[model samples]
Target: MTTRINAVPRAVPAEEVEVPFADCYITTAAQHAALRVLRSGWLTTGREVAAFEAEFAGYVGAGHAVAVSSCTQGIELALRSFGLPRGSLVLTSTMTFCGAVQAIVHAGLQPVLVDVDAGTGMPTPATVRDAVRAYGPPAAMTVVHWAGDLADVPALAEAAGLTLDQIVVDAAHALGTSAGTTPIGSQCAATCFSFYATKNLPLGEGGMVTTNDPERSRWLHQARLHGMTADAWRRYLPGGSWRYDVAEAGLKANMTDLQAAMGRAQLTHLPAWQHRRAQIAARYDTLLAAQPGIALPHRPALGTGTHAWHLYPVRLAPGIDRDEVIAELAQRRVGTSVHFIPVHQLTYFARIASVPPAGMAGADTLFGQLLSLPIHPRLTDGQIDAVCAALADATHRQFTRKGAS
Candidate 1:
């Protein structure tokens, strides 16, 4: 099955009930920041880039942050930074986006897929332990914070017999999330964040890797920009030297000043945006909970962690075709999305890893029933109501009256 990044479009694009599945919450601050970057004349990596890096690192409580082109690049950089030998085992979640798995393969490591917890859509200590037991110790592992709910990394690491340094967190959905006292980026070897247009901190396109190791930070800083000793920020200064040396060969995944400016503005307003997202998700929980044959997102127990609510996913009961319902909802002009098709089920990975859907019990079960409702900061109360009403109607038409018009 093909994956659609945004929700499938409505048949006629309903005027009465048009709600997008995701919308970037941009404000005047972001506009002005972009304008400033445009007028600055020095558009590539510059002062704005440095400031955004510092501010994002502070927000996530990480020691250092290196801005990159996208979450995809950040993951690849994190894996490549480890310098693991070729064909080394790298276990990761089967429920996550393809980027994590792609990064492992691109880094010349063999990916061993692990099933996720059906409740949280995260690989558990048991799952990791089982994979490690089957595959033997891996050189490293990547844990994805699915739908902004963080996995208990320490527990997972211990269960898998690996140290913190051997783990990289795919935190694309978990910018502000935490587990107990530890935030997402601060605990892992390196945590990668996305600033995609629809992300919590939307900047059109960008990413950041946060880590405690200064050496790794320095390496990533250079590694993102073709291993140049000093970025244009330093090289373009009046006293800056044009002569620079390549410390190591690296990928061209550096974030531009323009993107950094918008990101900085988004970062400033993130707390408010997050609060709004939570409110929207709460409305979803209340709206969808009373109905039978549907499962809401499994929220983390209070004080255990915070949910970023990047996507509000629900699983339909058995016998309901998830795609049919999604199409029905789109007919009502209410947008919906699927968080993922198990990476193992996608044609490319299925061909490479060659794991049948039945092999990953949790992932297979979740994939069949998954659908993400319209959830974002820009959704109005009436829009939320329309979404819920459309869902209720879709269920009624699809299941309660199966053969009826």
Candidate 2:
């Protein structure tokens, strides 16, 4: 008989791993919360939405908060509340999501694009001033906290001669961002947040609008449910009258109880999630700061509360092609994405606003070299290291022959 060796066999060729740009963290808490809502049998905009709104308002230090179908609705409602005439100018950042600009357009207001600061990637007070000077007497101004960077809201509002009512902040990425010691929502007129699946506070698809003014809060509440004084919550309850009138032309943009339940669970974990995000972001900052042909995102010297760290975008140095780096990263089975392509560059805005290319310098420059790495609560330390290593390696391979700037 032949003696057979007991050595392990060689492995087959491994397939490329699929990495996502962003991933949501859902645990038993989410499942339990969702199950509770299911058992209650009241799934629409009911008590859950109300409770979540109250809790979120308290968390953000706002007098009131209104849960809506989406952040897009929040922005649209904020614009609608202005009662601004058709074609009235509203200044906003060029480095923002299309939804921000689209909301202005949807509300019959003309969008005036303003460039952001190169370092912070946020709309500066001067840029807002310049936009206002160019398109003076604006009906409103939407200040977007781009990629969780708190823009100079107070200075911009003051420079633009805008009252608190005229300053609506699209704080979609700024759940934990602060202006000095104050939170983002507390400083603006109407602060809108996104709980979209990819946002810092993911509710799958939901949003909130917070305001210090009680009157505005009440209006938003009614407006969220088609301007009906009493929503289905009251209409369907026992001993509740079905008699209700449509007070005004409103939108069908109310958040469901299911969405609110998820929001509540997410909110409960927000503090810890935010802390972890910051730690990861800080690590990225420290590790990536010294890399050749790489410039990591900069945190301003002001705020102490938290950064939210919704995105950790870095700018590649001159002569390094961002697309090539992204391609290399993809080839290495790493995930990457961009925060935005610039509002002014999108085809829809270009057609309607025809915003000149020259004025949006910050947005243009940043968009070409910007690439966001995977940074979520679910990412492990090893994953973070892998991302950092891949990024550095990609930069070297892409920019080695070009010479350093």
Candidate 3:
């Protein structure tokens, strides 16, 4: 028998518990690391950044890692490293952060927005194949590890008949996620991770690109800092040369020592943080199991992989106004968010798109009902219960309203 939290509707009280949709977890070690960087004379990309790259590479089992200012820059640099022709189509999911699509565009590549699996909100092998059939074969693809769930890149590539080198992964939410025994960063040509404030590894602003190809890694290292052969750290440091060559035009996207120091410190606490996130997700599963008019997050089968639990999104039943439910939850002092509003539906992308998107029904359907609840290391058991209770009451009100209408 499964345990369930009772969902009884009640009037809103003056002191309802407050639950934020997301929060950053910063350890004391991270704070100390930041202070140490401040005290050091060298603040730009230097020893700290190098150490963070090596540690991150080792953690993800990647051959090489290059630190960047943001995941968006990492993806752009990764795509540019491919040297694909201008206007080359890069297949990517519509249900992702705009940064992924923006990266492709910044690389001078056209983004072919592919539909995702309605159930998982991730593009599967079949979806990739469908996109290929509709848009012709793309030069490459950017696979997003949605909501901390790792997509099967090898299988998707094999099904689409593309080489591993043709795949770039947006692992913004999947720092600790793995597919079977393989970690996320090691599966593709280049995998990018975000250390954004609200991410699993909160470093305010930092990203890393992991690749097994040495040549690509070397290219990214230069590409991140204006294509210079050497950076200021090398030029101004002792026994350093000011003479350098600009091999190619690149963006200013290097990660600073301060961010890297914090990243290194936060990496140490990732395991414990991930464990707590899992526990919160399990507690949500138990509490919300019996609630009506809502669907829980999809859990991958046992042994397939581990989720990072960055976001816990539930889908509301059909005909319930998702916005109204969100408002209701806010009234009850519970915060929530929608994962995304399909990229194709965005005003800018839609107006710029040359052709209409095909096979977007899945993405369209999923976007309407998606609602992300609070799920982070800081969430306590009582908070989880409060979130559930608020959600239950809010949805019940929506259902009742719909029935009456």
Candidate 4:
């Protein structure tokens, strides 16, 4: 059940109905914002980054938000601040982006990869309880709100013998999501967001860290830019001193003005974009539900949280060849993707977390069957039908080929 992509290349007609898996949402305002930065003298982490940080923090209801180069760096920067000794254990899911596992390693902590909910792709309370039972309590934990579904961090914390104070949320997907009316940013010790081109609120590349902890917040601001007491923007401003000092060896992970300009523009439009995505997801749920053997993604519980719907992943029934189906969908001019290849399956992690055997029972079983359909805000209604029709046709063909129907 390894999640290897199919290698053979195939072509689809340029004039045929084609549905892209992901498309970046950009507006004239975003372009104008970026151009405004280009026109400004300060191109680095200057006023725009500061503005985006403040605006994002206000939106997420966090005390502070630090803009970083990327979410991977944000997580690494945050974990390093904790001063956990090298090899100190940290619990996380195998069913996530490798950056999470790599960040734990980069932060000088040993990652104990555990199983996730096979169907929903979430690391549940059970996953935490088992990891705690098998490896003992970790110094910290990182939880991903799988596909923008809010994780019950309170239950997860209780199971892992930690508190909400020790959990960092890999909320790369849950920017607009909420848990029981509380936005995700206010629900964890630290929350990291990505502005990768495909995210709900994307720039080409950027990230942010939001937290309620003031001391950690201040440390993060200083730590993002060479641990300098004052950034170039501040130091070069009027009434600013030329003299400054570095307090700690830190990262060059500061967000640039240009990136922030784009982020701010996107942030302004995020609510509208979120609504569009929700509409698309609701349509997909209705359309894809009719396709036999395709299991739709789980929505966030009605009162528990609002789903960000970052991805619209579906699982094929047992015995279907997912790779073949993807190729089949491609032939029908529909693009498709898998959310992740369980971290432990990667050769580098296999060597590092080799002990405990990656007992990723659930992720191991779920790997081959998952596929993400296009659900971006820009997708047109016609394209939606194309994608679903292609999926249904592809599924019927794949099952027929396998003689499973």
Task: Name the TM-score of candidate 2.
Answer: 0.92
Error of 3 at 68 (Å): 0.3
For candidate 1, write residues 1-405 as lDDT tens digits.
111122233344234878888886667888888999899898998888899999999998999999999998998899889988888888888898898799888878888888887778888887787787777888888888899986788888887788999999999999878887666798888999999988888877899999999999988998999888987779779998988999677989999999999888878778777888898889888888997768999777888989888888898988887788888888777788888888988888877752423368888888888888887777776777778877777777666676563
Per-candidate count of clashing residue pairs (backbone under 3 Å): 0, 0, 0, 0
Off-target runs (Cα >4 Å) in candidate 4 are: 1-15, 354-358
In terms of lDDT, the best-performing candidate is: 3
For 1-405, candidate 3 gives per-residue lDDT tens digits of 112222343444423667888777677888888899999988999999999999999999999999999999999999999999999988888899988889999899998888888989988787788888877888998888899986878877776678888999999989878888777898789999999988999887889999999999999999999999999998998899999999888999999999999899889888878888898899899999899988988766799998888888899888878998889788877889999999988998776543334558888999998999998777767778888888888888877877788
lDDT of 3 at 17: 69
Q: State which candidate, 1 or 3, has the greater TM-score.
A: 3
For residue 373, model 2's alpha carbon misses the true position, in angstroms, by 1.0
Ordered by lDDT, highest first, the candidates read: 3, 4, 1, 2
Off by over 4 Å in 3: 1-15, 354-357
How high is the lDDT of residue 99 in model 1?
82
TM-score of each: 0.93, 0.92, 0.94, 0.94
lDDT of 2 by residue, 1-405 (tens): 111222232332212334467876655677788899999988999999999999999898898999999898999998888777889988878888898888999888999888877777877777777777776767788987777876767788787788877999999999988766677786767999998888888767889999988888888888888889999889888989999988777899999898888788778888777877888798788888889888888676654444668999888887888888899888877889998888888888878873534488887888888889887777665566667787888788767656543
* C-alpha lDDT of all candidate models, in order: 0.83, 0.81, 0.86, 0.84
Clashing pairs in 4: none
Residue 397 of model 1, lDDT score: 64
**TM-score, predicted candidate 3 vs. hidden true structure:** 0.94
> What tens-digit string does per-residue lDDT give for candidate 4 at 1-405?
111222232443333777888887677888898899898877998989989999999999999999999999999888888877789888888889999788888877898887888977888888777788788778988889888977778888888899888888999988888988778897778999999988888887889999998999999999998889888998899999988899777888999999999888878888877888888888888898878899989877678889998998889998778888888888877888898999888999988862344377788778878898887877776777778877787788877877853
Q: Is candidate 1 or candidate 4 better by lDDT?
A: 4
After best superposition, candidate 3 residue 399: deviation in angstroms? Answer: 2.1
Better of 3 and 4 by TM-score: 3
